[model samples]
Target: MGLRPAHPFLRRVPHSRGLRRLRRLTRRDPVQLLKQLPEQEQRARLLELLRADLQSNEEIADETWQMPSLTADGRTADLPGFNFQTRVCDLQILQGVSGEAMENLTKTCRLLFPLDGSSWMPCTADPRCLAERLAQEVFEFHAKGFAFDPKRSGAEWWVQIRDSGHSEEGIQFHWDTDEVAVERHGVNVHPHLSTVTYLTECGAPTLILQCRNSLRPSETAQVYGSLAGGTLSWPKLWKHLAFDGQLLHGTVPKALAKRLGDLPHRFTFSAFQAMPRWSPVSCHAGRFRTRFGRRRLLHEISCRLPHRSGDTTAGTLQLHWASKDAMLGPVEKGRKREMVSAGGGEKKGCLKGEIH
Candidate 1:
């Protein structure tokens, strides 16, 4: 048998005139064009171009990981304080596996989001391990990234993984503990870290938080915009409280806050309740006692209870303060918001919040 030549048509496709024209169109300096056009016109044109690009890329076979299909219909996990922020109305549904989970989810803004494909991107190792993984990842990432001062600072980190779903298509994300405080401060609270994945094909992993924490029944929640799948890390918790970093950085002027009464603090209470899978005592012995509260501090022991049993609630309540202490601050009532360092004395009351 003789070796055969590859198709010349395939080899020469790159030099096609159509491709050349497309390259020319896409290669133009968008900044230069924007400079030439009126500001409003420039913004409109850019949006149109972006929409066109997104639409055109739909047919392009994504070279990245294959997105998981929603094979499992839907499953829900109901636990205490699941909706402390929004009443017992929080709901989280497990869809399926996403691509390689990333760390430091908040820092995703640094890298352009991979918008060329349809896929679920998880931040934790396994679906069951979501909360644990989220907590650990946030801790390690922030510990390394944020230069916290131990002497003058009692800075705390709060982490919560919420189940966000609606109809057939939806998403879930990590909520900050300081959400309530941020609303009061009219400042941005760093999400610090978050993990998000889409449920449907057209579903994008976007975090939509209402500004001013709207109370009107007729008004809908504000849309924060699409969040890329990955880890985001930041120093102070105050920086992420706003709607969009673009507006925060002044890269783009926004009318949302002024027009819609959108304050940086407006956000609906996240509806995912966190159940503590592990306690500080599990981390060590002397450490657990030192970290937990002296008022209700009980011996470190594991006792199985029904999914919704009263005993489980009691157990969760006991460990709640300790967990918050461990995670630092920005604690939410009802959910495990922090982790107590083994042996650290419980010096603070449940950092001010309604226990879900």
Candidate 2:
């Protein structure tokens, strides 16, 4: 079987990927070049724009999101039952994102991943889209060389919102887990990485457990629990956390989900990413070696096409971070355990820092 990428307009072409890219780049009109400035001037102007954006991006992040500038302790917290190491960070950087950005984001979420929606929402792979840009920055800075292949990557995002009023809808312990897609050449799949970007903070503390999904391809959910992982609470408005998607995790104890009487509505933006189309992940080793020889889906994200309802292949195609268009820089440090000082002293039982 061959690789079928998650793009409505993309198809596996039996040609030299390199040659195709060269042709696209060189097909430019020579007549236009004569009317424009020399190549050196173009290169210098491009660098100027990049440098200017990079400098202002941090300032914009501080003002726009209003997240704290806390630094991470840099210690990887060990999940008890699993072999993965997770680190937390404060991702406070973005420039030129207008105040309406959040409004646009929530609007998209409601349109795509409704509050009562059951199916995961797919994102169009536009380099200009906010979600695509943020995901690219996160993966580049935080993926830390995880075992991901650029060509086979898939992405899906969803949102979860709970009003401050008491409710019994808190999540229980679970893994993001794998499932089979219904596409023509569908296969088993799981998100290689999962992320949570807090849009608003309440008293809810997300308990990331020490368990990882070791179940077989056809296996069902397994029982999991332990105090070996870590607890993240008191999130800054825009704090971000990431970890192995397969690890067992949950937010707020069922009993306390409703009793945080003084907090704002809980809203979060989450994404499952880098999920290659295969089960038992090792299957990738053999598939990549044989199919399409050395071809790759390099232009997947940059090409914009008309979207179709029947195209379930809609997912992000992140441009390589090394490309000239990377807009945000890596966060300086992961957020440290936050301490809430009241009256005269720090709150006695704030969740301990996950740093080991």
Candidate 3:
């Protein structure tokens, strides 16, 4: 006897309390809410509600977007240096759409897993129109001297709605090597240029650290300097920022992660331009690995050291790949001592360093 199919009315209901809360949060104008609160309580309440709502939602759990990978050759000498450059200007090109329209687009769009905890979905905005304008701006910035052809190079365009939370604890410092695509095909096609258009101002400022001068790239041209660190803020809504993809950048420090966890409801539209040829070396991972070819191995180094302020109590220093599917092992002490990936492989290393 064949089993009968379940009726449509008998289908399981989606219990996404987090998604519902998110919808409610976005539906109301944050500016009006802030205005309604007294000045003294505004800051505290804003932070509180943002954090509480996000924390309450089980669907919006924090997860790292990318983890650092080791090179196949085991030589870290060729690693790409950190060079972050920012340009602030009016995004007149994208002014065609009204702010309300953009906000609505961000709110109603579907959310897809970014392979990281940061869920993302495509935007309703026209990808081709945005790409064309961005390409024109890039050309104007270089005075027609830019070698890469946006159209001829087969640049891929996308408008994604990204939602990240305090659970992310600020993404670990990493680069956007377009590793997701490369791993799928095991090919070198990756984004060389990345542009971010801020749709809303809801999170902590992104902290960009400069790679040490000793680690600067040996070949090719580099922009920005080898400074220690800098913070990028989105003071106004609808501001656009573009930067080279080959940079070692991360979010705020661990100290401020708690306070900024849910304060910012980051909504952004991003575009990625691909390179003409694939390079064997990746900015984040030392060498590219193809999916289904071999098991990709990651090395994690952890150590404990006293605080830089001369405190005797030891603080753990963790250097490991951030996994999307890894189940963390129990904490032997105050820190997570070990992590086991979904694949069941285990490896460990140690490194001692002064914590400042």
Candidate 4:
């Protein structure tokens, strides 16, 4: 079957007029048009851009393997500061994924995202789509087996591409708190876990923090209290790494500070949270299911979190630091911000924000 125009990014043009209009648009060069347009307009989900680049098509994998964990594998891999030994275990890295599957998935982004004004897009993949398969498989096998809270957890995932000009300033640290899901429930919460499925080899190392927002409320008026945990660094390519989302994480963006040098872009399938099923946040994931159908899904994840991106607060604490060694400035006790990281014996970027 031919590709359908169900998404703005994958518009199906029929008829002499529509085809002619697209031909005209494509003729002028969509990339140049995107650069010239206003930021808001450029960010819009544009059929023209999608079609131009794609006409230029719209757009993965097979193999499956799960990392060894105490629950499923009887023994997990060794990472000095990683929480592989946590009560239910806190991290898992998947390997031996089918190259065919990822190639197809990356095809979905290659032409459009780089040329479009935005670095990311809100999208859903069908059961046949690799993204759906990746998320569902992880939930059924690893998450369920490792004790990820399903009632309060569903995957919030996206396929991301990192530009070569990655910045140290771009990396911010925080925990993935789903406070909004339980806002009406009257209790605070965080994503049960998180995962990253790599489409490309390692670019920059993601700093998985030892710190997290405390599930317990602050006893004193002391805003936040932190018991620093060591750090874990370095991520291998073609590996799937899953960890407790409540832990803080950020990446080493500067290529100079990282092993990767001179590469232009990096790709990965990332999940910030696996939200509660009943929350409005989970409902945001529905658009993809509605469009793509039910063979598999990302538990209906909305690309953006409901909370603000402002200062770090109780459940949402943001850390400003360059590299892991760089001193982490104290987080201001500001209003709640939405976010999601790892391990270091080095006492740095240690922050366990308050619950209320």
Candidate 5:
């Protein structure tokens, strides 16, 4: 029997009676609630939503696409075409933590998982302690069916000092989420949702995206959005990794294509996304292994690829949480480097005591 792909939408919490009642009480239409944000925020949120949806659909298509791999022994490897690669894959489910909790977690992650090198936090509140606290809070919230205000929450969050802008040699990020690529007369119907955020704003590298199969340098590669004061959220988290550059091909419709051809510039907008990293732990005979370690291994795997970067900013942080029933295809045996830039870069060991 051939392996099948799992639909990420199935994991979504449907609009049950209790959920609808809660939404009514909160006056938050989870589907159309994004319009309530500021104009810039609204655009960013919409872009993310569309990008995620498109990416999911693409993944479904790719999984079903007939592109089996041939092994060294001439055997057929049942899988989709090797089109996209994950720059980073980190996954975590935030429970009791408010938006503030997620902020603090991001800070901790930047400190703990620097691309340039490792840096230590002065405080005792490390990743493990924070994860435990978040888990407990999430459990409580799930049990009680209530939402906490991240801004007003009286939680003591540790904030990392960040630069106002990127350094000349900034980091880069690229990704694809699932969506339909049928562009109309002139509109670019982005089918997936993907995001890239910069940690060290100083010398932050500009973003660049293009069609995966474009022969020339790029017809549509330029920088987009800033992560300084933005937040991005989709209907759910799993939707983030459903598509990539492959589906991005032929995604832009004629109208936007004309504008893009005329302007030939990246879309600079304000956006925010919560990139949560979780640790997968296992214990056998009292010995333990953390997902962080597994991720490091994955990073090492990426490091070995032929397409490596001399600049330390080239690395990406991947986060994911695997469920037993998730229908992930077999792990192919070779390096598959992603051509897109999904996340921003970080300066090595250059944490300033305070932002200037």
Candidate 6:
């Protein structure tokens, strides 16, 4: 037969009067309704609507590219007074890919991260494969090989989607510590080299700081001295930036906000490679170990900071963290606190005093 006609029943479902009325009532102006809500509520509703739209049109990239092989040593000379080199390069990692494909990947990643879950969202790529690809590239360029501990390491690619307009504060200036890394990965290991690849047009320029002293645990060691620092930004395509993770780094909020405003979206694919454990230079200089001979674990410590908004001073809460219990005092302006035993030995006394 050349063609077939559709049956009457298959053509359309007749709507009842009640269903028609319900549809009409539900078709109100979403923007007007959003305007009636508070700013926070408006944002929440908009995000929910955006998520629904993204979920319906989710597309995963099936195309794979050959991992680039290192031809010549691409490591940069270490900066003066710094143990590691901060490297930036434009790679053809996503070469032959289209703008539309990259956009889809970014949206998929953003949808993967549940709003209530951790900031990190796992990548669709095989962790081992991605790790190996990165290790080869890093070795070829920086002469640094990642310490791949699959059993106890969470060293894999991830994505971070940030809405700069809604972000309370830009990421504060901070250095990477093994304590945080261990919390992410089960092992007490920190990334020697951190790589960032932008998957969307909206991108932020990272600020890298060079301090006067090595960031080790010492009575005289300050959290940061800011001997020197510079901003690094790259195109949204296939370019990548690699840096010494231990060095203090943060984003330029103004620049990031501009990018986000221009594109209305921002996200990146990032990977962290733990330093080779056997290397003497890889040790975090006792930063990962505590005074009590216990392994330093990550602990969040919040403190009140003298926040100044232009000419006015507005008191604001700030968050600091200690690698271990003993370090909390220094992190929180000499605030003395006791670590009650995990057992019920001092339950009554603990209730009488604040824990932090």
Candidate 1 local Cα displacement, residue 102, angstroms = 26
Off by over 4 Å in 3: 1-84, 107-145, 150-165, 180-192, 212-227, 253-356
Candidate 3 residue-wise lDDT at 108: 27
Relative to the unseen true structure, what is the C-alpha lDDT of residue 84 in candidate 4, on a scale of 0 to 100?
33
What is the overall TM-score of model 2 with all chains considered together?
A: 0.42
> What is the C-alpha lDDT profile of model 4 across 1-356, one tens digit per residue?
00101111111112222223433665443344555778788666355545555454321111232221222221122223334321111223234546665455565444333342211112232343444355555554443334322332334444445553343222334444332322333322443445555455445444454454444322112213332332323333444555565555544443333322222233333333221112223222111000000121111111111122122111111222223222223333452553211121111232121111
Give lDDT tens digits, candidate 6, residues 57-120.
4432213312122212212122233325544453434456655644444443443333211111
Kindly indicate the candidate among 1 and 2 with the higher TM-score.
2
The models' CA-based lDDT, in order, is: 0.23, 0.32, 0.30, 0.33, 0.24, 0.31
For candidate 4, the lDDT comes to: 0.33
- Model 3 lDDT tens row, 167-195: 23233333343333234433222233444
Error of 1 at 123 (Å): 17
Better of 3 and 5 by lDDT: 3
Q: What is the Cα root-mean-square deviation between model 4 and the actual structure?
A: 18.1
Query: Which is superior by TM-score, 3 or 6?
Result: 6
Judged by TM-score relative to the true structure, which candidate is superior, 4 or 5?
Answer: 4
Query: What TM-score would each prediction reach against the true structure?
Result: 0.19, 0.42, 0.37, 0.42, 0.22, 0.39
The alpha-carbon deviation from the true structure for residue 168 of candidate 5, after best TM-score superposition, in angstroms, is: 4.1
Ranking the candidates on lDDT from highest down gives 4, 2, 6, 3, 5, 1
Candidate 1 differs from the real structure by a C-alpha RMSD in angstroms, to one decimal, of 23.8
- Candidate 1: TM-score? 0.19
Which scores better on TM-score, 5 or 6? 6
Q: How many residue pairs clash (N, CA or C atoms closer than 3 angstroms) in each of the candidate models, in the order given?
A: 34, 3, 3, 21, 54, 0
